[model samples]
Target chain A: MLIERKWKKWVFFYLPMAVFIVFTLFPFYWMAITAFRPDNELYATWRQPNAAPLWTLHPTLEHFVGLMKTTAFPTWLWNTMAIALVATGISLVCGMFAGYALARLKFRGSEFLGTAIFITYLVPQTLLFIPLADIVRDLQLGNTPWALMLTYPTFLIPFCTWLLMGYFKTIPKELEECARIDGATRFGAMVRIIFPVAIPGILSAGIFAFTLSWNEFIYALIFMSSADQKTVPVGVVSELIRGDIFFWGQLMMGALLGSVPVAIVYSFFVEYYVTGLTGSVKG
Target chain B: MAIVTIRDLNKKYENGFHAVKDVNLEIRDKEFMVLVGPSGCGKTTTLRMVAGLEEITSGEIRIGERVVNDLPPMDRDIAMVFQNYALYPHKTVFDNMAFGLQMRKYPKDEVLKRVRDAADILGIEALLERKPRQLSGGQRQRVAVGRAIVRHPQVFLFDEPLSNLDAKLRVQMRVELKRLHERLETTAIYVTHDQVEAMTLGTRVVVMKDGYVQQVGEPLVLYGQPANKFVAGFIGSPAMNFVDVSISGDGRHAETEGLRLNVPDRIRAHGGKRLTLGVRPEALRIANGSDEHGFATKVDVVEPLGNEILLNFRAGGAPMVARVDPGVRLKAHESVRFAVDPERLHFFDATSEAAL
Candidate 1:
């Protein structure tokens, strides 16, 4: 029976898990190899006898160095970092307050309001950018970081609110009631007890919001007009591709470098992020 | 240290569910008042209204001299211990205990002193530095109690505070809570669904059902003379056996399908009327030869509970249990004669269920 169970587990769990890992990680592997492969190896066709498409015989940092020096990669990186951080901060504050009110407060049509916020989240970003672009023009925020900074929260806030609201609901109402009876006002209880207890949820929300804004394509592409003003995603795609010719080597290097910050963030807070989504406050 | 007076308290929820209906209670100073009943009995609702956690639809609640009807919980100068302990998960035990005082802006020295004192009293001084999740259920319960007591508030509200503990821990905590009440002398309103907790810990117990107060008195008084059938059935373990019967024409006997017993003179005025007879399990005993009034029934089940053996049988078309000495040897389907204790018998009106 035990051996049979082990065989079943191998078929059901480990086999699928290995397939999923390879499928997801394959793109990153291709990107890394292309970024390091010497120019001759990168451009060589599979028909060539000397060509090694699967593994590179020679590796070099020429593409990374060339991309960094020839383009405004550092400026784009800084812009992405600053915008993602600021947008995440704004969305998190709004999300925390909105989530708390929706989850905890008793009011007329509060349920309707919560559903309405979620419905807004369901609205596709593809359809939203048109009206958002018009608003950006009216506000004179076009071609500026403010365009993306303010627009990112339009999607980010709803997501964070929905997520944090679920997290807040898992917390027992007794905690706040006890705090209130312990001489803390409603606001005080929220700030002192509810917010502190929700740190894991908050961090997870921040990480998600940061990633969303960092990799955001449509609004950043449309809003940012200058080479230096653009975020990493738009800057690399627009500047590296020079019409009908894909700069695979430099583009791959940009993709690899662009993802390092997000990777580092996930690694540092992976434990908290997992618990935030899956674990409720249990006494 | 406070007298809590709740007058004509009524709570109607938004969806038109009337949760608490006209609850009037005057908890005496330093009294340990327990509100107990089955679920949805309005016991916890009444307690929350007193704590200012629930809004009063219509009524007035006064803590000491102040009318606290419109006051928020923080302004009521009361502390509450929740059923789940509700200890802050991130804070140390010391910080949890000191929170109330810190909120009230007490000096740092005073907060430390009070926290230490409360931790000492709870015998949890060593756990002061640990978070709530690090402690056991009993230890977390102590910390919750410590949090409430450290405030030295005018009143303490407990919402089934020990319900989460295991059976053994519950009993120990019950004794500790009673002792703490005596020592602190703070008026407390505790809500629970457990009758045993109410009976053992309450200076006075209030029994509620279906959003109304059924009876309020000393535990033994409520047990001995329940205002109605509900209280009689609710207050005792194994519950009071209720059997329907009618008084005989002579005003001498009560008769039913399986029982014919002499009616006590005190309730003979209602002769010839249909009524319900209530008998405590302990009040029925295996009859001796000298006993003139008795009933014979076949034991359906025998539960030997160490100190006492419970014999389950059918009488008057209703199932009944007799609490007899453990030495009584009886088996299922065996014939037994039980004498009902006439003095302890209770009669209630068939329709209203009120004691006669």
Candidate 2:
């Protein structure tokens, strides 16, 4: 409001907005162009007379077809989907219960327990993986989908629990009290009233858990050394490049396609997701 | 219907702070008992303890001869309407009304019938399909009422349920709630900070302050005969006028600076003792000529409320408001004379604050 001039508005508002949009969108644009460019054009030096790194003169689905036909990319996609979904489901259930307990129940050490759960989320994945890899071998779960499926929850559960804990606190305690007065037991009231009212919070927690598990790298890479069990991130890096050579097109293509499921999940729950982040409940 | 009897009830928090002192009350069957207090008076704590939402520090609560000190809220068979209307966001009004029955394992048809019946009572049959968010604030309050009534519980509890509503809607809903209680004939304990709401809605009103019960009686009884100075002042709008006065001439009259008032015979026993005189705003009137009891004052301000006018004045060094006929015209800061009817005058011991 203070900046009344058109040029001043551009200097203060539109220019900064454009810079942020371009900064965020450039990576996706690069990924898209690289995914469609022919291999010869992708590999050509920028100095070559006909070479263009920013835009391709010709775009083709060759890399996508090659990714499907020549590599285990299809297998990788399936592994990522299955692992992400199960991990998200496991974490969401555990998060909802643990979160409700931490937020609503009155017991000794509940506050300490909540802080401990949040502390676990702050633990770096790199340090955690060292100890986790030992446990993974002790359980004899290495090189299987179960290795990552079970391990992803260690991090994802803490994240989901902390998120859901805050969300549950935003829900009024009166709802549960009213439910109890309405002849529902404590557990009954939680399930019937609290959980229903917390749908936005639950959906947002699920989306975050799904995205985190889908983009997971170190666990997928270390746990599954076998070709068929590898997820998209590991499968692309391991299988696409030969020694002293890079498969830039297929690498970009994998990253591009790998993000679609997470994108779709976000778009579907965008409304609930916003409120979940903002924690605004009407009535 | 059930009688809720609470004996020697007390509530002390985990931090060693006592919020409710020993309180004993018997809510008779079908009685609408209101606990009215200012903030921090523990009225809500008492109601919550009755609802089994708060643990009683030490007491016995009997609902129809069953000591429910350790019973859970669900087993207590009471329905509470919360201030925020606590409607499940994901459920339609129909589902919200039906949830309690479903949890109790009621038959499907019976659940539907109860929901429809309650909806009909609240005039929300058309809103059965809508979620709570789809309704306005007043409609949502009605839905909350519908949810509470659908179960036909033995007792009803209300915790400032109308405080969130607008003025007109609150008044309308207050009447509706009274009518609902009559039709249901269930014992209820209501807690509200608004004295007006308590006076209008309670069959018997319990006025509390600082975690202590100040007075309990019918509205007019509490109004006409307040037990203490606090009760006398707190129960009325614009507040009662209080001035320190000393007995004059055999204690038949009390005298303040430039004003003299006849004391009641009960208070005249302490002939030379200083006391506080209490007068309700409406009890003061414009003095006519030759009135012996008239006190002189300067009108400080005038508030012309359409039906009547209030004269704000200073008499005997205490600010006071007087409800006068709208036809009476007086300018602010103008000197005026006023008198109090002797019967309406209240006298209290200055140290004890107990009414005489």
RMSD (CA, Å), candidate 2 to true, equals 2.0
TM-score of chain A of each: 0.97, 0.96
Per-residue lDDT of model 1, residues B1-356, tens digit only: 58999899999998999999999999999999999999999989899988888999999999999999999999999999999899999899999999889989999999999999998999999999999989999999999999999999899999999889999999999999999999999999999999999999999999999999999999999999999999999999989999999998877788899788877898778888999999999999999999888899999999999999998999999999989998998989999999986777899999999998
Task: Report model 2's TM-score to 2 decimal places.
Answer: 0.96
Model 2 chain B weakest 10-residue run by lDDT: B261-270
Estimate, for each residue in A25-77, the C-alpha lDDT of model 2 and write its tens digit. Answer: 99999999999999888878999998788998899999898888889999999
**Model 2 lDDT, residue A230, Cα:** 97
Candidate 2: where are CA atoms >4 Å away? A1-11, A47-52
lDDT of 2 by residue, B1-356 (tens): 59999899999999887989989899999999999999999999999999999999998999997999999998988888889999888889998888788878899999998898898889999999999999999999999989888888888999999999999999999999999999989999999999999999999999988778888899999999999999999888878999999988597888989889876787768899899999999999998986689898899899999889999988889889999999998999899999887888998889999989
- Per-candidate local distance difference test: 0.93, 0.91
DockQ of 1: 0.88
DockQ (Cα-based) for each candidate: 0.88, 0.78
- Per-residue CA lDDT of candidate 1, range A1-283, in tens? 9999999999999999999999999999999999998888888899999888888788899999989999999999999999999999999999999999999999999999999999999999999999999999999999999999999999999999999999999999999999998888899999999999999999999999999999999999998899989999999999999999988889999999999999999999998899899857875
Which residue pairs clash in candidate 2? none
CA error at residue B172 for candidate 2, angstroms = 1.9
